[model samples]
Target: MLEQLSSVFFDEANELLDNLESQLLTLGDNPNDSETIAAVFRAMHTIKGSAAMFGFTDISSFTHEAESAMDQVRNGVIPVTGELIDLLLKARDHIRNLLDAGAEVPENYKQVSEQLIIAFKIYVSKNGGNASLNQPVKKDVPKIKKEDKLSFSWRIKFRPSKNIMKNGTRPELLIKELTEMGTATVVPFYHALAPLSEIDSELCYFSWDVILTTGKSENDIKDVFIFLDDESKVEIEKIDLLPGENNRIGEILVDRKDVSREELDKILKEHRQLGVILVDKNMVSEEQVQSALAEQQHLKSLTPGGQVATPQSPASTQTLRISSAKLDQLVDLVGELVTFNARLEQEAQEKNIAVFKSLSEQCGRVVVLMRDVSMGLRMVPVSTLFSRFRRTVHDLAAQLGKHIEMATVGAETELDKTVIEKLNDPLLHLVRNSVDHGIEMPEDRVAAGKTSVGTVTLSAKHAGAFIMITVKDDGKGLDRDVIRAKGIQRGLISENDNLSDNEIYNLIFQPGFSTAKSVTSISGRGVGLDVVKKDISTLSGTVSIETEKGMGTTFILKIPLTLAIIDGMLVTIDNAKYVVPLNAISECIAYSMPAEEKGQRFVTTTNHGKPLNCINLREFFNFGKEPPAKQEILSVYDGDEVYGLVVDKILGSQQTVIKPLGPLYGNCVGINSSSILGDGSVALILDVYQLTGLIKNSSKKAS
Candidate 1:
């Protein structure tokens, strides 16, 4: 149980730290934003309290000092500064380290913690008077006995159900929490206990009456019992203690006619409290008296500086944090269900039975809805991925002595969680490259008739079934002469080879290709871009670059929204089936054999009043059979050029679950993965991007 709680705390702590980093970054941008400062302080405070609860003393202690510094900022004692933000950022990172390491302290982490604490204390002292470096500055905690007009006494009756112990609730813990809020005098009642012969060991028979005096709001007290259910009986009332105050409890009871004025007067004449006398005489049960007290408390709490505490409403929707492994399993199951639905639909169509067809169609609709909803559950906003880059840009700009601002747009664009996770490294590489190589220095920018502050924009948008993410920078763009020369020197291209600007710009992604004149610790090694290309390709995504001579460079990544399943156009070639991603297919046109001329087999067609280049897949795959008399050309746009894939026949469309190709076929080009058809036969899902590149390479070799 303790381990489980510690794990939960670790996860919560990490999320809090991520939010802390983001808040600190915002604070750095707008130093005078009080709301952001308060948010930062609250995050730290929550982490500290939760850490202490989970026995993570190291984290708790470190966060306490950080929280104290933030508290100073919150209270207007210390003005926000870049140095303070940097310190807090480091503190957040240290807290994450502690969480990751658990009970074992990482080497030198203690030293770092001590240094940060000293820095925090020094900042606080520099702003004002001498501040203690050893002890954290404590905020004034509200007390029960403070001579404030808002101070009031609460009478609480807490009665646990007979089987409360069976529900794993420790009543003592609740009592202890209440005592911590103020001065609490608890009196236990054992009147409900049965005789020994009839007693149940697992049952709880005792109840308590507590008198609490506190200036704190009633919500504070009720929060202690927030976990209790309807089975527990709890009543709270404010007891009036002012001199000359009327006996409102008795007056209320008499007014409500629960007890008549004559009975109240008779009880009062017996020299006893009205409530006790009524309860003892059975004029009102204990519950009724408690109810009257509650009403009195509610009315009294309505006065100035009084808080009326209402029972917490249950959440209409609750979020359960399921493990990613579980979600992956669910997606896999859903994929299988989708495949089975396709088979059922095919069988129904083949049988031509009206009832079966109707049932199958309805089931198909339900399956489609389920697939969409389940996939949506795995979709999260890209902002979660975008926010991390702010810190990266900040640190990189500072280290490189440059002025760069990173602006993100369309962060709310949603993508599959798996895709976002896989895209992180590639995106990080692109952003870092933009900062290190693409963005020019401040002086250079000014000399070039531009603002000193360069801007790196990261934007994402939905494009049909794909998401297009672009990383652009307003800095020195790609130099055509330098890239051409590098290409020639690296043996990647001939010196006289005429290439479009797009093709030349793409040479940067070549392995071990760097245009940087000097090496730096950050980037001149020329290793990241190639890896970025490879990673993106592994996800069946495409990366393209657009640049000008002096304006800027933009790299756009086109990625499918999800990798689990895809809408594909299944095609047949030489009795074998293949699937083409529908998003990649531009259009399909009827193909007829062109007159053979000098061994040239390509055909040209008109699309949107422009010429389109077409390639027959049968010839490319070398199917070793005569071309089918009837065939179709599937046109696809590959960023720079449009090419056609001629197939033996079009096999209509399919919703396919992609099963990865094994390592034995890892060397295979054009085909990325295989999918199961409705007939239980496998069809290779074509990687159009790879095929286009291969086609280009093959054409070059032939020429």
Candidate 2:
């Protein structure tokens, strides 16, 4: 149990650290934002508290020092500076290392931690003293009444729930905290205790009535019990003391002439509350005093902090943290269910029974809904992946002496968590390339009629069934002449080859192709773009580049929302079945041989009243026999280029559960993965992007 708890704490701490880094980066931009400062301080404080609870002593101790430093910033003693944020960010990273290492202090980390501590001490000394680290600065408490200089007194009745101790709360610790404010006289009541024979040793039956005399406001007292739930009945009532003040219920009744002073005194001598006495003696009705008491409690519950102590509503939704492995398993099962449902629907249609058809249709709807919900469960906002780039951009800009500003749009666009994880490295490489190669120095940018600070905009939007993520930089775009020259020098393209600007820009993704003049730590290795292309291709995604000579460059990545299942257009060539992603299909046209295009692999057809060039899939996949006399041309769009994929027959669309092809055929060209059809046969899922590349290469070879 302890190990499990520690693991949970470690996970939560990592998340908090990520949040801390993000907030600190934001604070660097908006230095004077008090809310961000407070948030940073709170995150540190939470990590420290949880670390201590989980027995991570090293982390707890190290974080306390950083938390104290953040406290100074929070209290406005030290203004937020880039140097300070840098230190805090390093501290955050060190704390993560500590958590990762399970509180074991590695030697290298110890040296770094000591250096950071010394730096913090120097900053503290320069400010004033180390007093802030040792003690909290007390805020001046507002006086309720200036004329009345007497200390306020509160009568607190705390009746703890029987299972309060089960949650690891110590009542004595709370009482001790109360005593720290001022004089506190706690009187325990044993009236609710059961007989010894019937007692449960684990349960708490004691209640406390305390008279606390202090200068602190009621909020100060409430803060002590903030962790307690609504089941713990706590009531705080102020005892008024003034010359003409009717301080007690009986006094108020007598002052209102509802009770005689003799009756009040006689009932009070019986040692009961004045309200109960008045009600029993018929001086005032029960409802009247009850209403007054309720109003008094309501007023007292409104603390000086301006927050009411209302019971937490249980109707609020709660979230449980489950392992990602479990979620992946569930998604796989859902995929299987979808595949099975497809087979069932096929069977129902073949049988042509009315009842079976009706049931199958209804079941199909439910299965589709279930598949959507299950996939949605794995769909998390891309912002979680995007936020990590802020630190990257900040550090890289500073190191390269470039002024760059990053702006993100559609960060709330959601994708499968698995896809986001795989995308991180590719996105990082793109951003790095933009900063290092695309973005010019401040002086150069200014001379080029651009803002001194280059802007890199990362945006995402849903394009059909795919999410289009684009990383664009308003800096020096890819120089087509330079890229073409490099391509020729690298023997990637012939000097006489005719390529468009887009095509020239894409040559950067060719293996060992780079236009960088020299190798630096940042880029110029010519490895990142190729790896990005390969990774995205493996994810069944496509990448395209758009560039202008002087303005900027944009790399757009089109990826599916999920990889488990897809709506695919099942087609057949010869006897083999193939599945083409529906998202890639534009339209289908009848194959016609133009007289001038005889023996040509691509035919010019009109789509939306414009000429379109389509690739014949049957010939591309090498269907050894003669082409069918009447074949359908499936026009598919790869980026802005529309091409035709000729098929012997279009078998409509079906939900395709993508199953990975083993390593034996891993290098198979133009086939991304395999999917199972309703008849228990396999269909090759075409890699449209790779197929386009193949066609381009084949055409180049023929030329």
In angstroms, the error of model 2 at 121 is: 2.2
lDDT of 1 by residue, 1-703 (tens): 8888777877877888888889999999999997899789889989999988878888889888888778777767678988988888888888888888888887699888998888888888988833674466666642222244365667677998887889888887888888777656566678788999999989888887676767778888888888886799998777654312344788867744689888888788888787888888899877667766754555443433343333334762466777788888888998998899889988998999999999998987887787888888899999999998999999999999999898999999999999999999999999999999888999999999999998989999876557889999987888988988999998999978889777888899999999888888888788889998998877778898888767898999988789898778989988899999888788888877664611234555666788655566776677766786677878876655677777778978767898988878766777878999888989998877766766566566566
lDDT by residue (tens digit), candidate 2, 632-653 = 8777776646667767889898
User: lDDT per prediction?
Assistant: 0.81, 0.79
lDDT of 1: 0.81
Clashes of 2: 4
* Candidate 1 residue runs with Cα over 4 Å from true position: 133-317, 351-354, 494-499, 584-601, 607-613, 624-626, 633-645, 663-669, 689-703
Clashing residue pairs found in predicted model 2: 614-643, 614-644, 615-644, 617-646
Model 2 earns a TM-score of 0.72
Model 2 lDDT-worst window of ten: 239-248
